[model samples]
Target: MPKMKTHKGAKGRVKVTARGKVVAYKTGKRHLNYKKSGKTIRLKGKKFVLFKGDARKFRVLLPYDWR
Candidate 1:
């Protein structure tokens, strides 16, 4: 059989946690920060877990990593 291929884009942006959850950096942090609230900015600094529906679809792309 052919080797499993990793999703390069997903590999760059998402991380699998030890418990098999996908984590990604929060969005809206890339631009227009001056209008964003302080709390919003702080929150954007942290990562968030992917929803169950999305995770299932993405898991197929990231076949090798389960976390």
Candidate 2:
């Protein structure tokens, strides 16, 4: 009888693509980057899809995002 609210945190951090896949930025680039390799630095900010299991979980948190 009640509508579900979107998870605010997830809404800010995750994005739903036109095809309905959940995309999120990779972690571990925020600090101590000087010690990391060039390749790691280059790769850190890229977006990636959530695994099927995890995606299923986010689907509920982002109920309206699938459409």
Best model per TM-score: 2
Clashing pairs in 2: none
- Alpha-carbon runs more than 4 Å astray in model 1: none
List, residue by residue over 1-67, the lDDT tens digit for candidate 2. 8999999999998999999888999999999999999999889889999888888999989999997
lDDT string, candidate 1, 1-67, tens digits: 9988998998898988899988889988999999999999999999999999988877988999983
**Candidate 2 ranges with C-alpha deviation above 4 Å:** none
Alpha carbon deviation, residue 12, candidate 1 (Å):
1.1
TM-score computed on alpha carbons, candidate 2 = 0.92
Q: Global lDDT of each model?
A: 0.90, 0.92
What clash count goes with each model?
3, 0
Candidate with best lDDT: 2
Q: What is the lDDT of residue 29 in candidate 1?
A: 93
Q: Please give the RMSD to the true structure for each candidate, in Å.
A: 1.2, 0.8
